[model samples]
Structure formats: C-alpha cells, structure tokens
Target: MKKTLYSLFVFFFFIAGLTNVRSQDISLPAPEKTGGKPLMQALNERQTTRSFTKDDLTLQQISDLLWAGWGVNRPDLKKRTAPSARDFQEISVYVALPGGLYLYDAFANTLKQIHNRNIGALSGTQAFVATAPVNLIYVADLGKLGKKEGDEIKDAELFWSYANTGFIAQNVYLYCASANLGCVIRGLVPKDKLAPEMGLKSNQVIILSQTIGVPQK
Candidate 1:
C-alpha cells in the first residue's frame, strides 16, 4: 500500500509542474514608446551597474524593459525598437526569472514560457544573478539566417550577431537608467552549460547576458 501511495504522489507532483509552465505566458500591456528623459540625457546616464537587490520587478517594468530592448516599433514593417544585422532579427531574448525561463516574443509582446526552472543563475557567474529580478539571455538563432540544424557556425559568422546584441543591450541599459533601475551587461557567461539548460538548438548561440534589478544601497 505504501508503494502504491508513492506512485500517486509522484503523479500529482508531475501534473502540478506542468501547470506551472503553462501559466507563464504574460501578455504585457502596450509599451510606452515615448516621453522619457530625452535621448541625450539617457545617453549620459547609460552606465553599467552591478550591485542588485532581490526586489521583484512590476509587470509594467518588465514590459517596458523588454519593449525597449526589442519590441516591435513599426507595425507596418514589423521593425523592432533596436536595429539588427540586415534586419535578420536573429537575437532571441530568453528571460530567467524566479519562477521559470521564458522567451520574449517581440511581435506579440508576450513572454512564452519555456520551462519551469529557475535558470537565472546559469545566466552568469556572479552570485547575485541567481536571485536578481531579471536576467536576459541574448541568443543568436542562426537558423533564421539560413543556417541549417547541424551546420557548424563559426565565430566569423557570428560577428554580426555579437554586434547586434550590443545594440539591444545598450538599449536596455538606457531604459534602466531612465527608469531608475540598475543593470549590467555581462559576457562572463557559461554558455556551454547554459545553452542546454535553456533548451537552445545547436545553431543558436548565446552571445551575452544582462542582469537587472533594484540597486542595493
């Protein structure tokens, strides 16, 4: 009887886990694309901030941050807020939060829940990464650029991707500055270990990661 009860317990636990993953599709409200501290002021305030508190970000902040990073700005042409190489728009932002991992769907303005695991720590080597409010993993999907599934993408082919990610990250930095938030774009990421955790394809390369949260005073 004890053995039979153990099986039932495992079955219920599995069902609860699936429910969690299905619940993270966040349909963010319309992003405010205008009225900030002006371009020149935002540029002056754009600086890297590392220290972070464990404060959770509000839904509006999350929406604004993702929108500023890569939301669709032009509905007619489907152009994003940040520029991409040849308009490839290859970079995919995977967010690791306390609840789970999610992919930021730029066009739909929603976060597609990928898995029910807190993989934020895998985003960076820093201790605070595990507990930060948000960690944005910038992954370059080569398949969008005509690369096949098993094609070995070289570093040379990734030059444009790296440059493209920088533009988006810079946008996030500026947004955080304007919002009085703290953020840092980090390159010291364990890609090989994190890629599998993020369930990325072989052609999808993780270029960099950025951590964001309230500043620790």
Candidate 2:
C-alpha cells in the first residue's frame, strides 16, 4: 500500500509540472514571408466567415497569420505590416486558443502566455466564438496615447485606435483568404467581462475580436 501511494504521488507531481510548462511562453517559428495568392486574388477573395470547424490551426499557420496581421516587416525601422496613427502602435493582439490566452510579441515573434485557461467563450457573444480554434483580440493601450490609468477615455480619442485595428484586421482577412481559412471580425464581445479576464490595465482597452479556423463544410 505504501509503495502504491508513493507512485501515485510521483505521477501526479509529474503531471502538474507538465501543465505548468505548457503554459509558458511559446517561441513561434519564423513566419513564411513569401508565396501566397496574388494581392488582387486575395483581395477578390476577402470575405467574412462565421462557420468554423473545431480543427486547430497549425503553428506555422498561426505564425504566418500573426505576421500578416501586424508583425514587423522593416526590422531596421521597427515598422510593422499594419500602419498605426503617428506610429503609436497602441493596438496589441491577444490570442485566445483552446490551450490558453497569449499576447503576440511582434518584435520577438513569440506568443507570451497570459494564462493557461481557455477563454474562447468569453472572447465574443456568438456561439461560434467558443468553438472556434483561434480568436484574436485587439487591445489598445491608452497609456501610449498619453492617457493615465484612471483618466476617462473618450470615443474621439479612440478614433485612431479603431482605425488601426481595422488595418490589422484587414491584413488578417487577406491572409485568411489566401490560406483558405475562415474568419470573421467581431464586435459582439463582452468587454466588461473579458477585460478583467485578460488582466488588462485600466488604460488598456479592447478594440475588437476576430475569430478564425478551418471553414466548416
């Protein structure tokens, strides 16, 4: 009986360690920069899709999608694929996957784990959000725009942030179109509920969320 108990304890401890390691930051593969449908073809195919299969996006696909969305293109200038107002670069992309929540570090090309718990259902109000394999949350840091943590943020002040998010979202859309993936830019997010879950600071604001996955046939 004593030997059996010791074995059980060791097994549980190993499992716990594995879970912890799984939640650590992920170094994404270098994005594939070349080769996709022609620009005009991707534009022509650009569309919104709501039905997504439960199939998960491969690591390569995730890396490429993020690069297309907002990754750094001109490393020397530290410029990104999507333009930001005054180059503020206030919008940050947070990824909600079945495994956990992660923030995309465009410069490092890494996914910084925010938490291990899956928060897909909390990402949006639609039923598809919960089941989708990937959900991209766009957050704007008002502090970067000169607002203090407690300062009241106005809609006018967020005009540029909204515009920036649009640029990034569109990039993702075109990438999806080219990759034959399904995606939808969503506005029906429960921000009040999600902000805390994301552990966002008072100055960090949720701008939009996009759901992505394989198209359900």
Report, for every candidate in turn, its global Cα lDDT versus the true structure: 0.91, 0.95
Give the worst 10-residue stretch by lDDT in candidate 1.
19-28
- Give all TM-scores, in the order shown: 0.88, 0.89
lDDT of 2 by residue, 22-129 (tens): 659888999999999999999999999999987999999999999999999999999999999999999999999888999999999999999989998999999999
Best by lDDT: 2
Looking at model 2, residue 53 earns an lDDT score of 82
* Model 1 spans > 4 angstroms off: 1-22
C-alpha RMSD for every candidate? 5.7, 5.2
Q: Model 1, 23: alpha-carbon shift in Å? A: 3.3
Q: Per model, state how many residue pairs clash.
A: 0, 0
Which 10 successive residues of model 2 have the least lDDT summed?
Answer: 18-27
